[model samples]
Target: TGACLEKKRAHDREIHLHEQVEKNYARLQELEGQRDGLTYMIVHDLRTPLCSLISGLQTLPAMGELGADQCEVLEIALAGGETLLGMVNSLLDVEKMESGAMKLDYTLLDASELITCAISQVSDLVLAGDLTLVRALDSDLPFFEGDEDKLRRTLVNLLGNAIKFTPAGGTITAAAHAGEDKQSLIFSVSDTGEGIPEEDFERIFDKFGQVSSRQGGRLMSTGLGLTFCKLAVEAHGGKISASNAPGQGSTLSFNVPIKPVQTIAV
Candidate 1:
């Protein structure tokens, strides 16, 4: 009788454990479904207004009745519109990638060419911010297989952050080097501006995490760029990190495997 009672108790415990597991699994599925629905709704709703705003702002320049000051204000408004559109597009692209919906075309991308185009895209902003841009691409760097558009966005985000944070007369430098044996390409973006404090270095890479108290404040950004960078790099199966320069500013570096990524298509 004693042995039978013990066996019964063990069976009851196993059944209770199975019931708890089922409950937790159901909760997880419900939460995931809610998250997916929210993302879809937000992205869908953003496009309509974004299109209207950009279209109306674009038409303003064609009207010649405005004064110089008015035209300048219009230009600023249009610029803000473009920035918003870009942000929305970026968010959607990130969602697609996260959902495994983005198809990446893997091709041998010329590092030099990619860097030049990405830099040109943001050259105006850097110049307007009074920051000097510099690039040093190792000629011997081997061609690597990756998605060109994604890499371009990654580089642009890095350079844009550098320009935005660095004060007047600061310098932003980008360097690329190919590993001799590991078949990896290492790229680093360094800025000669206010450096991030030691404690906030890792925190800044976290999603929606801001280093404002140490670097500046929330007035300048929405804090999404770095998070996007982190996600893009991970999608490419690469690692990224940030470190403070000895005297001033910070360096954000990441590497891509030089050889073809066999397991993943992108």
Candidate 2:
């Protein structure tokens, strides 16, 4: 009876691991962040040219009457090149943001615009996974002072994580509401997925903190992601947090000053 019970528990754990792994981001942001390394330098140097090459390849299909075989090869090249370029850029962003070296360009920007741009970027990914994307914008919200680019990046990361974590037919909602104090805005990204354990609410946001999906094997942790999100929000006199949602899934929310009193360094 004891042995049978243990076997049943092991089976249940395996099923849970499969679900978590399925929810993981397929975009593969697992780039090793090794600055001052030859590999990093090479990828750094290749980004610009690879981007240019991808662009050029994109134009060829439209500009010329190429054979089907030739067009297929071009398509493959474009896909592979873009993947490499994305990884290169991801590493750079993580390194710069983590080091607190990148300067922010502060502006009084419409939160609506920031939110829309981010949704647009991640919408295709959400759809590809057959997940529903929901948006809830606070009406007549006051304009906030912050870097549009950085804010958009933060939104993208949050939404991207949602898209990656939710399974087919699941819902991922991005919502915002103004603070009662009239000095801040609250933003949230919630998804229907394997919810976080109550104890991990704080640890997940720590740098390099990891979650394993299966035994003796590891699933890429969301630790680096929460780390980056926390830093980005805090850099603007804001605070970020994570918690389990009702029924299932996790909600990551952050509060930002409506008008950031601390000037963001250019």
Candidate 3:
């Protein structure tokens, strides 16, 4: 009877251990759900001011008293509006992704064409900063199946950050090529800007994490660009990473699988 009791106690202990692990897991899920809820609320709240600022800036240009000084202020206002709008959009996009609501509409796309269009969208900012933008896309790069919109957004965020952080005379380059195995497309955005600190490299991809050590404090950060890039790349079954370039800048790169899909005719 003593041996039987020992076995019963051992079984009870194992069951208790399993119960404890389950309880901890449940608690973790609860905490994560709460965090996501708070994030959604905060992102939703930002939309109001973002819209208001954008609208106010649109009205500023029409004000009758606009002089050179006023024009400068208006320009600043316009830039701020753009920044706020971008931040709100990034936050909402990430929140949607986290909630599993972001749907990827994959289509066969020419990588070179996509990069060209994305760069054009941000050409004004790059030119305004007097930074040279270059593209080194492979002419023979094959088409890949993916969500073009999200991929373009990820590239834009990377390029925008590159342009924003780089000095006026610095260079920003976007390059794409076939991966070593030719089964994936490897793309990178490099800028001759203030490099990222070694310790903050990974943290920079975390939500609300920004590179604060740069000369200009938060000069070009809403703190969501890299985070959004991480999410967007992962959503498309890709890998994204960042490292200090050989010289005076940072390089952000990602690899998306190059699976071909049948072309659908309209």
Candidate 4:
């Protein structure tokens, strides 16, 4: 009886040790997950400082005379830096929007002007892509209330994608008109590049959603660009949508009321 009692005690001890080991293993997994998340956050936050560095580097060329080759190298570096900064800012902006930390500076403005400004920012991109630009903004379009800066960014994002996706010799159109109700303005950026698949229509607007370059196939997508557009439009109490026509191309558009429900004078 004594020997049997001793064996039972030994078995209980082994079971306790096994349970403790499992608990420690789970805790280690949790810590590793936290570490990964922290690392991702650190990498994203690094963009702001890098952008500032690139901006500083950009001024160096203008500050002093340099050899033509040196200047060219500096320019190339600056351009790449600017692109990196853009991605970082895009990711940070997504975080801000998701956390409800963004506030719009709404004002009464001409919406077409926003479109034109957006096109101007990407004019070089269009030229680089060897794509033709077609502008058909309605002349009689009425003024609308919106955040000019946000709307400008939205147009830039759409036009940028259009330019990236459209092939050489293809055309991109920036068109706007009055909505069916005549109380809202509708804007679209259509590109004759690799069009989006029908199944991705809804998913494209999601956070970190599937986004491909105009070159097609899946590239590394932070998915913040279109998500930013959707949020900006909704902030104005507007709706955004996406669609692709058969063998034509893809069109991304948004509609905002002629007068936003809430507006402030600038």
Candidate 5:
């Protein structure tokens, strides 16, 4: 009878420990949610001032005939401000998407028009980097229903990522084609840059995940670009991925259903 009583006490202690573990886990999740809310508020507040700064910088060029040096300096400052604003907006959008608060603004989109517009937006940067921008889109890309602005931003983000790692004289190609099933369209951005390590293929999509460049050191970025791209694609009922080229560089691709069967609450 004493041995049986000792066994019962041991079982009670195990149950207590399990209950404590569950409580701790729940508290950890609650703390994380509060931290995320705080961060979102801070980032949201930053957008207003950033926009005003960028607007002031934009007006300076048209206000008067600026000297060559002044114009160059203004351009650089404006670019930086715009980039920061983009990062802030991305952080907010990512939060909304993760919380299932963001809704898709679906519309009929022309594949060629979408690709062309995205390329045009980044063409100046591509040219400044001494990089070649190639278009490998299929001729028969059909009209698709999706959020036009978000999809364009996704392509731009992918192309921008390519431009960041690609060396001078390297090539960055933007390609689009229908999937074999004809139910979706696949878009890819491939760059002839330092290839990604096989280990980082998935991690790169995580928030704030950065990878070291083979050129020398760690690549500088907010690292939310790919995360935004991933969320945007998945919200369209699609999938995104990264892969290495045979000899060098890497490709980032995503497929959006031609007719989305369901909306992702992500």
Candidate 6:
């Protein structure tokens, strides 16, 4: 009788502990949801004013001719504003993507043109950073049907990351080629920066994930860029990954199907 009573008490305690754990987990999820909602609202609100500021900056040159010094300063200001606006837009899109509220706008897109446009967008930044931009695109990349804007932004985000971590004189390469399957195309951005740690290969794509390195120091990122890239790529029925050789550099790559099995509207 004593042994049976003891066993019963132990079982009761175990059940109580399990219940407590479940309660704590639920509470944590609720808190995280609330935080995400607040963030989405704030970031969404920032878009309008940011657009107005960028518009005014754009019109400044057209308003009148400016001195060289003033023009250079204005250019820097506009660049900064545009960069900030991009980050804000990324935050909103990430939220929409996570919530399955975003839709993919499929279009007939030229792979080479997409690569060239993406490179052009960040050419100025690449030059300013004293980095060399290498284009390794295959001459015969086939035309694909996908969301052009999302794909372009994905490339830009990868290049931006490379530019941020890469030191002056480093080379950043944008490459694209037909996948062996011929049903997909592979695109990659590689940088000769302090390579990412093996442990961070997956985590770097997580929301708000940041990688710290001995040589380059902590990455200065809000960490949403790669998350957005991952979601965008996956939405097109594709996958993304990161890899690097020790002491060499890192590459972030993704593949897109020539035609998605299904156009996802989420």
The TM-score measured for candidate 4 stands at 0.78
Q: Model 5 over residues 102-176: C-alpha lDDT tens digits?
A: 988889999889999999999999999999999998988899999998999999999999998898999999999
Candidates in order have lDDT scores of 0.80, 0.77, 0.85, 0.82, 0.92, 0.91
Model 1 backbone overlap count? 0
Worst 10 residues of 3 by lDDT: 257-266
The digit string of per-residue lDDT tens for model 3 on 210-260 reads 666567555234388888888888877778988996676999999988873
lDDT of 1: 0.80
Colliding residue pairs in candidate 3: none
Error (Å) of candidate 2 at residue 120 is 0.9
Q: Itemize residue pairs with steric clashes in candidate 1.
A: none
* TM-score between candidate 1 and the true structure: 0.83
Tens-digit lDDT string for candidate 4 (1-266): 99999999999999999999999999999998696567559868797789788979878968989899998898888888888777777766766665567787768888778888888999988888898999998889888777898889989988887886788999999999999999899999998877887777778877677665445366534256788888888878889998987788999999988877664211
- Which residue pairs in candidate 6 have backbone atoms (N, alpha carbon, C) closer than 3 angstroms, thus clashing? 100-266, 102-266
Model 1: residues >4 Å from true position, as ranges?
1-29, 215-222
Candidate with the larger TM-score of 5 and 6: 5
* Highest TM-score model number: 5
Query: When superposed on Cα atoms, how far off is each prediction in RMSD?
Result: 3.3, 13.5, 4.7, 7.5, 1.6, 2.0
Q: Once superposed on the true structure, which residue ranges of model 3 sit more than 4 Å away at CA?
A: 1-28, 59-65, 210-222, 260-266
Error of 6 at 34 (Å): 1.6
Off by over 4 Å in 2: 1-43, 66-80, 203-209, 213-218, 223-226, 263-266
**Model 5 stretches astray by more than 4 angstroms:** 215-222
lDDT value, residue 34 of candidate 4: 90
Give the poorly placed runs of model 4, Cα more than 4 Å off: 1-48, 211-222, 262-266
